[model samples]
Target: MLIPSELVLSILSYCDGSTLATCQQVCRHWQTLIDHYDALVWSPCCERDFQKGLRRRFWSLDFPDPQMVDAAMLSSYAKPSTLWQSLYRITKHWSLGQCTTSFLTNYTLRQQKRRPCVVVGTTQEYNFFTSLSVAQSGHIVRSNPMYKGTTEGRQAMIVHASFDQDPTLSSFYLEDDALHGIVCHYSHPASPWIVTGGLDGTVSLWNEPERCVARTWQGHRGRVLCVSMNDQVVISGGSDSMIRVWDLDDAEQRGSIDISSYLSERHDWFQGVGEIALNGHLIVCAPDTSGPVLIFSLLTGSLVYELKTEPQDVAFTRLCLTPFYLLTKGEINPSNRNQVPIYPNTSSSSTPTVSSSPYSNTTNSGSSSLSSLSSLSSSTSTAISTYALAPPPSLSLTPYQLSRYYNLSSNNMTTFTAARSCIDVWDLQTGKLVYRLVPPLPATTTASITDIRISPNAAHVFACVEIRDNGSRRNELCYWDFSNHHTAAPSIMVLPSMTSSSFGNAWACFY
Candidate 1:
């Protein structure tokens, strides 16, 4: 019986790595079938490939997985010298790597180390936005403004900063003024929105998405960290260990739940809502509380499944509901805030406090298929592979466990720690820790990470920039774009390493 490739892919859920290798070899038709069904690939594979890139592991190899180190297609991965081979084609984190046509002999060692970046349409790269809040007034609230680089001795910039639009109106106003950005919500009844939990402790929301915040709540004693938005519901978590859900659809605090109360009941030191994962009508909030991620019917707002996290003490950072697995971000300390995670300090990173919760593997068929190919193909470039001095013992992490963790923290911190980074990514399908996307810093490691933001487009891409030490880097917005060539990391070719935030959320209205 001849099975159609598309039909085969249609029925079976693809896991990454070996699963994909097996499926693709079924027949030429299978290969062509899955090629078009790349969405079937697990989300974690993307995270893994990106991690390979940060560690410079992917540069010299064909596959992102270390298992491919001596595979039959080693030549197919990288030809001759490791510096110039590519097994997969990607359009993110736009950086200048190697060229097979020109001989390295023609250039000096320094030239080889130099990353090739050219200015394209825009030049203002600022920071990675943790929770991208587009206020109606064009004011932007940046989580942290820390950037590392040539400015090492300067004051540690706040990981949270606000961009001003108009003090009056509240709305996600798309305007074109040089000094203003979308900041607040419009007080008008027509449109209402609210921004909660930033690098700061403030929690506020407006009645309209295009209007100013009509109410601001300051119940949490700590910084309001992460935020989630759905129909008319806005959920926020913070260092205070509280998960408060606000019904924005109504003009009142229609419904609310306290994560702190649950934490106090459990007698845990850090029992609060660190992050929230949302699916259609279901909501799962990760907390220090001992249970599977707290799941509830998002619309009904009632308790649902409490899947045990298993024996591992893994806390989720990010979660999404779709064809992908129930995803979660890696566990990082709330205070572990250097703001920029360009690379994993595998050598010195502390072993995460193992959780008593049992973690169910989240990898599924759809996400695994895509996850396999990307994971098999990408790694970090040559320049990032080796370093003269490893980070201090306090910051080092083991390379072997790179694929084991996922971090939901931002990579754009504004501190002076050498080991901390701002960027972290995860596989949305399998809940596997894939990679850490660190902002590209200079040789001196001067600027710390500031804020981070991912492209809202179809492509899963994000960007990070260093803080502005002087007035050198300003007038900014976001980093990646899917507009042309369907490329991520568009700023890698068009702007400096850091991005600017002079514009609002879409960053369309540049200052």
Candidate 2:
């Protein structure tokens, strides 16, 4: 017995995609009804499941006109009878870690013998790498230096690689003679604009396709070490112990904070800012292991609060920002006898007292102690910590609105943290520990994870594990699919003994 089409539509509208898929298999009549009104059956579910969540995750990079962005996204899956099909295809592809990789040529290294190279910066859009020799020469010259190339000194090479097309490489030179090398660079995921901090204490913005400097802002007295940006402003930290905020639109200095002066009254010694994370409203600055993590307001440039972990012995290495929380990765100090404590207070003050833990004892804060702590092996004490993006109610109003009130879904979003031989995946939203991926190593062999990167979609994890073989060290690149993490073997790919030139500057991005 077949129900009326009106009744069928009414009944199925309340069901999810999986349920609708089940109903389609009952009979030809039901399948026809399902196919005819596929949009009605899937539109609401798609909006709730995919559209809202992805938009929230990528809110920082989304177009200014969100309605048009929504329309464009929906139009991509506009087939009348295949809306749910397209949604399912995309989700399954990401979950199953079904991706193809093609190696791009190392054009710069191909001309000469392999040299030590380092990755200067990377975003989901592009990867940047440079060799010490090229950086010192202040330019990339061909094998024949006399022959004039299209580009010269202090240049950045851009490569365009797409899934279906071949990669095309080109270079653009910086016009400033004082700019010797690039210390750090950042690429906006949404825009073609690239911001670079140079050794010459100057920051330059470039339009990638045109291969020319759009603007240059000079303020830092020393070389810039870190940079972060959003749609409105660019934030940079340098050896000058100053954090400068620049207006992206006009390339003018909006504000500057002398970190040394900000904390001078409290601590006798303050290291310069090492890394910084800038959302639209808040800035989190990590100076060094000895100093507390300083939180400040972007609008007024006021100190919001200071965060100190118990034991306070961890040397923070990297910081990542999300809409709701700030995450940090560091190495625990084994020399300290106390266990790490979580965030102690969330109040703001002009001069807050540093925590009285043994790690904070001023008497022990000398060069010898610092050098001994630094000499400790990092493999044994690596850890990751999370803190709220803004201070609690008494300190400040909640600056992040997307996650709490808007119902931005944050489930199943995982990030990998490495400690010695094991890698753990944690849910960023809830701070729940999910999976501990252990590399398949021999009992006699000792291994340590050097680096771990998560795919943009958070569905896959890539780890670089180093193992010693007959006194020679080798690196293995391992890939894991989170969907199959519970299985005995979730590793999809393992490339052993990757060469320096081939894999040194490699990064992965999905379309």
Candidate 3:
């Protein structure tokens, strides 16, 4: 016999995939329940017809989904029916192979001929957006999500940005140096950053970059390969063969001795310094293949430990500290597939002209080596302190290795090893290797793991393999949930098409 209706309704509420579809067609009451429940509780994109129903019945104001309309119609007066317009405006022109989440104050590069600097914010009533960061060129703009045709609705706002305040400009301790591309951390929402890796091979620190430089650090000599900071301190690595650490509070040299000065003078280029993690006594750096990250004794600047990489042409490409600061939020718009991420771009609602970078000029300076640490001196350290010694290089390992963090889930850990396509996974707590979760493809499938990226929230991790179809380079993403990873393999999720600018790539935010 068929199940009772109330019991079935209760069970169906939690049902998903095809099972729920089958239940809905069982009876008249079942159909009504399915339709009504879908519109009210299920996600807005769940029903095919419900979205069409929204435009005619709900949004008296006109809004259209950018995905459905051409660019010509995006600015046209023809408004979509109410139900879907709001959702459509929130999510349009999202792209694949990119990941996004709710970490507030991030900039979303919306549709534009050039890379557009778009600000995203939130408020109780609706979302707010200004014109794209205008350059010398004319400005491109999107209608305020809450822009009411009437004056009354104009005042009613929903989404809003954090940096509406007029921040006073100030000079920084850092000097005017050549700049590589900018990499910033918006983690400390109150005190954001514009950490620049310099061409003169120095690192400069800027406070929330509205109008001034907060602090400048003149440390590295070669191109500053990477820079990452957190609540506790500012860390930088460069081609100068050193990774320096600075105190965040007053930008003081941490610990008793200034390790920042002692080590940077030793190597030729510290190239890719991977993510950094400060664990009580150990300051760790995971870097590209150049050398082992100098884990100095934060207490003495003495090299305490080393996180070695597989010996290869590896400098760290990206380095995040131990704490995975997850910026997460829900995707309100289905087609958009990503919520507007927050960026702490502090400027005059204007985009700055970006160039190929200062390092582009110095990259060909040729390989040069330093003499010795005989002159390496900490103002606080006497010659006796200089003799204390650096960490002895790795025992059997070759010069430094090319080790990259391949995949990290809430449930598993994976790393790229020496064997080209090989990646290893381990248990998060025990550090015991979890061999089952490794990539199932043959070792010959990929040239390298350059396309691997983990979602900021750690819910999903994606890796794009270097496989080719015809003459075109075609890579596919393998997505696995952080929670169920130990028992699960990633399902392959791909871009619908090259032209598909659907919200952030193969990942979604959930918090």
Candidate 4:
């Protein structure tokens, strides 16, 4: 029996790529039919696979439009025979994380080689990067901590790194009154607007593409620690212990919650609001102290639940929010020394010790010998003697390795909280701990995780670690692939010490 070409194509549309491939091998007639209606059959498949793969890889479905993708596919593969082949290849490449890393070499060179640039009445300020956010259009928007008056230094800039054009950087600045110390900034995925909060207690929304301030709202009474925005509203938390919600259209304060009441319960007067995250219908606020994380309804501004860490002494610092899950960072209470966990060293050599404990504090006297294994002489010799005299390194289960034992699938939304020296992965639906990842430290180095950011797709976790050796400090960026369960060590990228030193308040996001 023979089937109509249109009917066959429609039937193949419902089949996935693998099924279609198998069907194509059945006969030459089937292959001819697939070739003739390649667009009809493969366009849907391309869109489906691209979106599916992107969501799994990046934890985001914010790719370019289908028509734009189709246009690119047609342009790259004009020949009918290679149409689906090119589409599939690109899809596979994205799925496999086969991406190349390109450093902003020019930006780094300009900073290193060039002399200090003077700005605003001889203030000798250099361009300092505070935060980076990627837009839906593939442009990177970076914010600096400098006041708007300083025109000499690169304050805020936007980089267009889309596929259609060569990468270009453009300076984005605010007006006279709009200038302030922008502590936190956010950009919505579906909008061209950028919302930024400053130490001056002002939240300004800027039209990024136009490089102009749309509106400035003075709602917070103190320094704005964090700000989150959606399509309709913007939520900001400040040092005044208040979380204020504002209407995006009118720039008017809609509702305000006095977090001071919430603060008083935990006796956390010193640590005000540290971080605020808004996802879908929920808003999460984390104080700088050991206060429990407060989750609120986005629409009504009512308390929903409070998520507390296992050890009550661990305090939540940073937070990341997805539609279904919330990730937080917890620091061990500085006042409580007894709460610190001691791990035993597993290495064969007694001289070199590894501490799996995340909260292991290194003193200045011991850092010199452990900074670099190669440089064990000179000032480090005395430190090594002191180290040898000290107790053996503690041994504990490595957190990263523990994550491998879980049989959990990536289909559900998972929350990752980096507490003192450990990362706890929780399933949002069930609120059950899935994995606890502890990064293994080198024998010679004592490291503390400074920050952690899960990629938008949730496939990988990026951790900023500070390593101290012999009183010298270095910063390393660690990348952990969550998708591959069998993978052991995380890939490390060493950031320059000079740049890392200047990054007192920094934020990292993956595109």
Candidate 5:
């Protein structure tokens, strides 16, 4: 005799999360009831678990409230039961340090006309890419190292592939021989536009759908170091210590800012624009490794603010800017507090180019050593003051409300840490330390982070980490999921060809 579906669901509803999971595997009838009516069965389970102890203390303000989602704003995008269940599972997995990894693909060097240098112990071979971009659709595009050529041709190329698949050899090449090679590039997350900055100081926009150059512009007197763009504007920082703004539509020059003029002294020939982040309105630029980051108005080409970092934490190679906060990766000095000092340009009118650095360039008072971490922790850190940058009208919230909405308390500040293997999140509104995120790695191995990328909502952070274990080195692509997206898939399919090396020798890791 079989039990009635209603009666079975009622009985299952009384069960805990673990018991409910077990019931689904007992028989097809129970599985059907549970899977079809997941909302009814799992919603309560998630709430119960979350209330008891599954809260993530990340910077997000939407904690303990099972109804509010910090990542996706659309209610139609995620079903209630599914979202709750996914949240429960992901939180449990992250907190308990549980995840499965698999090797995807590795790169090999092809035979070249010039003598090739032999690579040793996965260090040089694995660090092949200089810059990479990821889209919302899971497509990853990588700019190749600026070298002479492969067997293909003298011009440099950019490789495109999906996150789960191997990179295809078919790529867009910089055809102009005058532009010695490609240095940096940016790809729109949703659109078909791709912009590349070349050694010859040329920026070319490529239309992926048409697979041809849409437009080109040349202004930089030296090699372009970094490039970033939106749909309307393209910003390029070059080795000439000049940052140029271009209109994406007609390829006309919008404005230019010389980095050297603002600095205290002249920069070395090797020290040029190293990183740039653009959001159409503002351009955050770093000229050299150690930085007093300069912010420029994209439209007027005038200096807006100057952000100074402690000497220990000023080796700025990466820059990510949101509407309110600026994130840079550098050497981390872990102290009781990890606050970023923001200095407003008090002399913007009288001396627009003068740096407003708080600390003297000679004094290293802020320098501190990094502490070791056995596991991820939410321990508190230092504090700083917040600047009132208005939240976008789209959010429809004031700076105070925005801070409270994001659970930033009353500090109105944001804080971040830059340990090699760890990343931190700050509340720009409150000027307080929010979250310190570290990827789950084995306690026995030593790991170093190569790159870190944060989603626009600050809900997800992706880390590309290389770990050394028992004399062998391997890479891992790890992400911290704060949203209830399509995480619980039926099964994972590993590509057969992805297991083998396409170029020379391959190294692979699970996603």
Candidate 6:
């Protein structure tokens, strides 16, 4: 008995890539059928593996993987099957942490003999970068803080680097009402405008082509903490507990979500918006309070959902969002702050030291399919009792005060020892905790996360971590790749040593 070709192809559509590959080896007929209907069989597989097809659509051609150079062009004009295959290869390369690094050299010019160009400030006085964003077009824009002896020298400007021609660089100083530097800024892949928030309680939209502030909106009574904009709307979160939205076309007031209004306790400890991620239809934001992470509808300004946390979970200070999942990082409970053990830096020595205690507690929910993985082994339960516990530093400081202090601090230090360290992954549809990810560092390493960036598809997370051990400090770019879930655990890689000074001022973003 033989199955119809149509029925055989339909049956193969339900099988995964591996199963189809196995089936193709069964007979010549099956192999021919599978090859003929490759698109029908593999499109679903690509969607399943690549975050429902978003990753495949936005995968960069100029990836760090040198092998992608050939595949990049193939993906542009290839068939659906070819394009998906190219995407799968790129994702698999990322999962395995395979890449090559290269530095540019210039020997002809004396000034640029060794290094290609300075990455930081325009002038030698203030030669450090505070914030930077990489666009999909390969344009790099970074904010440089300049403080000369005079009033004119105490200004900040946006430095734009374009590699389209001869690796050119230009500086555009954004004028603010208070003359203060930009506090937070965002560059969207789809838009050329750079939206910035400043200490003057204003949000300025700069036209990159024109090199001037196209418009400025003053809605918040306090300094802005985060700003993100697209072609249509500008969204900003300020210290005033207000998430304001403005029309990009005419600078008209669209709407605002007062975070304090949603809090039932009405406590003075509530801080303003910590971070925000915007898509087309919704805005997911986390306030600088332990209350709850709120999601609001972008069109109607109505509350969509609130992701409440456990009592032990402190305030969520950082978060990024997608249609299906929300990625968040919250502070450890103040009571357990000092109880957490610190791991010493072990990347330098031949033998990496493993502490007898686990860094953070891992608990799995019985109802949810998600399971928390503890990176290190041992019993920290008894270690906490051995040492006298000191009062949490935040006991005297309000959450608002803590948030403000973190913003103003140069190192972005945490008052409490282990604050906002663990990354939590939650399912938006089910509203259940999916994964509680602890950075795979030494259990006892005293480290603080300076910056975090998520891939466009939320399949990978990169964190710039600063580790201090034995009076010395170094920086590591630690990344966890979750592309292949069938593996026992996520692939973890902590890049080698970087100077504390240079890495401290560095910022990263996923285009």
TM-score list, all predictions: 0.39, 0.50, 0.37, 0.54, 0.53, 0.60
Model 3: runs farther than 4 Å from truth? 1-191, 208-212, 255-282, 286-444, 451-457, 485-511
Candidate 6: which stretches are off by over 4 Å?
Answer: 1-129, 144-154, 160-166, 169-181, 230-232, 331-420, 457-459, 484-511
lDDT per residue for candidate 2 within 1-511, as digits (tens), equals 7578899888877664445556777788887877788667755644433333322222221111222122222233334355454443334223112222111222222122211111221111112222211221112211111112244533343322211121232233434333435666665334456667767778877665565678888999988877777678888888888889999888679999877765544442345676777766677787743455676778777776565543343233345443333444432223321232321112222111224122123221221221122111111111222221111111111222122212322442221111223343222223332223444444455445445544322333455455555656545555443222122221121111122333332332221
Cα lDDT tens digits for candidate 1, 1-511 = 8976556765544344336555667777765554555545423443343323322211111223323222222232233232111222221221111111100111112211111111111122243322333333233322223332124322111111122222343222322111111221111111235443434455566443332345555555666656666546666676676666666655444455565543324333344565575433556676643334666555555655454332234333334332122433222233433332323232332211112101113223333222233323323232232111111211112221221222212343322133333334433322333334333344443332233332221122233233333433332322322112222122121111224453221232120
Off by over 4 Å in 2: 1-181, 257-271, 278-284, 288-311, 322-445, 479-511
Between candidates 1 and 6, the one scoring higher on lDDT is: 6
Alpha-carbon RMSD, each predicted model: 15.6, 17.2, 24.2, 15.5, 17.2, 11.1
Question: Which candidate tops lDDT?
Answer: 6
lDDT of each: 0.34, 0.43, 0.31, 0.48, 0.48, 0.50
lDDT of 6 by residue, 1-511 (tens): 9999999988877764445556767899997776566567756654443333222222211122213222323233234344443344334323222222111111122222111111211111233435556443335555544422233555545444333133544434544435645777887444568888877888888876666788888888888888886557989999899999989987777999998888777434666787787766667787765567887878788887788765423456556664355667543445543433222111232211222212111111121111111111111111111111111222223456466556535463444443445556565544555444445544566655545566544345655555666876655555554332222222221111123334343323221
- What C-alpha lDDT does candidate 5 achieve relative to the native structure? 0.48
Q: Which of candidates 2 and 4 is the stronger one according to TM-score?
A: 4
Model 6: how far is 202 from its true place, Å?
A: 3.5
* Winner on lDDT (2 vs 6): 6
Q: What lDDT does candidate 6 reach at residue 266?
A: 43
- Model 3, 100: alpha-carbon shift in Å? 20
| Better TM-score candidate (3, 6) | 6
Instruction: Give the Å error, residue 318, model 5.
Output: 2.4
Q: How well does candidate 3 match the true structure, expressed as C-alpha RMSD?
A: 24.2
Least accurate stretch of 10 residues (summed lDDT) in model 3? 381-390
Better of 2 and 4 by lDDT: 4
Error of 1 at 40 (Å): 8.8
As a TM-score, model 3 comes out at: 0.37
